[model samples]
Target: MISDSMAEVLRLLQLDDGFDAAAEVAVRAAETLGVDGLTVSLATGGEQAELVWCTDEAAGQFEDLQFTLGEGPGPDAVRAGAMVLVPDLAQVRAGRWPALTTESGALAVCAVFCFPMAIGAIRVGVLTVVRRTVGPLTDAQIGDAQVLAHALTGRALGATVLDQDKAPLLHAVVHQATGMVSVQLDLPLPQALLRLRAHAYSSGRPLLDISRDVVARRLRLDLNGNGDGNPLPVSDKD
Candidate 1:
């Protein structure tokens, strides 16, 4: 059953050639999966991110509560590079995100699923869905969600965010470069992103191009940041 839904995602990806069209498909897919609301956020830069697309006005409220209150499952999923599932938000309000969890549960959104949106090696955002019933996702649904998550990740890599210095969001070069640094420093993914960003700034290079160099292994990350970055000519197109 869910395989058919995943196939539908691929087919929808083929038909909808742009972000807006893709958003529509995502919302429809959620409906087919029995979710009430959905929000798809594409990572922006810095300590925070931006919400790119969302289904239903309720989803906007859900996102806003997190932004305004400064904590929630959505942000956690992005930062941790993992899915954040709230099978039932109603009773689990003593810790944090009180308003959000309570309101969502009150609205009969009992189960919430979040899937990380990742590029080849970088995590950028999460695909979030809210369900009226409180229960874990079945294996088929989880598999279908994974497929949609990948689709969303690919779309985010090509997205545009005015905040990222007016550059394309989740640039491929950055992801490649981050992977390269991750291996070199033996650091976690988020930490590696910081390293790549810092190196690019010190070298006075666009983060994307430099990241490409790092990912291609043409430019190696020096564990010691003291050395002056001598820009090396990287022939490979990453």
Candidate 2:
């Protein structure tokens, strides 16, 4: 039986019936779950999940950081096919998410909860909730979030089949930049992507910014570890 909170969220989702319904539901779900904000990301393939919708800037930043670093409650929940409830980021042990932990210290986030949207063997994506106040979710909130996650899985699948192009591709440029980097460095795609991520982490910049620079031909990574560990700025002139 769907709880009142879950029912309300589902009703909001039904009102849209378009590709953008996911965004509406995300905002409603965050309110229902009593969190500060939330984000929904759907798995594209091979450990890559693209952010489709987020309730606020903090939630979006948290999700983007996870994608850039490839480690965090969202990825862990997706990998394990279970929920990762971190009531307080400060309580987490060091090295759990080393780069994320260090980088996110300045953010206003204090708690994070991740729920995997999956059905048996098929995994769809993740629903991540964030709160500025450090505390575990209420039992009711957890139950409603799980229900919303399941509903979102079906919505995501339908969106893929109905209007795949209309679905937001927040990280499309990043993937294109990765491919370009791979060819430039004569490295495999995975290695090239890692180099981009490494530079983003070390330079304390968003992955999207670094990728934009690469795709725009304003930055080029080399094989001498300069691009990986210390990226050099390139002039816009050819």
Candidate 3:
């Protein structure tokens, strides 16, 4: 099953155009982990998550809940660059995202785990797997998730590049833009990317959309931070 899952993951990558493969991978991964359901959220988008694929009917509520609210394990995982696992949503009561957690219970999500998707240093999105029971992931499962992350990252990378086009999310564009944004803002690459994210979210737009504008001279980083970790910028093409 693991091998099959891995193969399915590779096939998902081959898609390079649709969500069908991604949905298949989610289902296969769930089977491999013996979990209840799974969903893969691609960060190639903006503040709002774009579902690359989700397995089963149950994944719908979980995925839509996050998209509608703009908050959930997937969002937090991408923001914090860490995985969030709720072995049982009902058991968590304090300091958790009240709305997101509450919705988790409504979705009947027992256990949820997320992994960030990134190429080299550029983050693309997150992949989340959930079960209906409380328990810890075994070492083997962790390894499997890691492999899935790597494969998903590759898929995202391939999809964004338009045959030698230096896209902002493309690894080459990311590195180059990071250097330029860093020098322009006098911030590190990480902070520059954060600034980019900040600018996009503040405008209620997608990060990639903002990135393209920036890369194409249609936007400039203004650097007037709003303390929400969002950077200020002027859009040339509003």
Per lDDT, the best of the predicted structures is: 2
lDDT digits (tens) for residues 55-164 of candidate 2? 88988898989877999999999888899999999989988999999988888899999999864334688999999999999888898888778777656544322223
Candidate 1 root-mean-square deviation in Å? 8.9
lDDT by residue for model 1 (12-31), tens:
77566676766778677776
Counted clashes in each candidate structure: 0, 0, 3
lDDT of 3: 0.66
Residue range with the least summed lDDT across 10 consecutive positions in model 2: 160-169
lDDT of each: 0.66, 0.78, 0.66
Which portions of model 1 show Cα errors greater than 4 Å? 102-108, 119-121, 159-238
Q: Model 2: runs farther than 4 Å from truth?
A: 159-238
Global fold similarity of model 2 (TM-score): 0.64
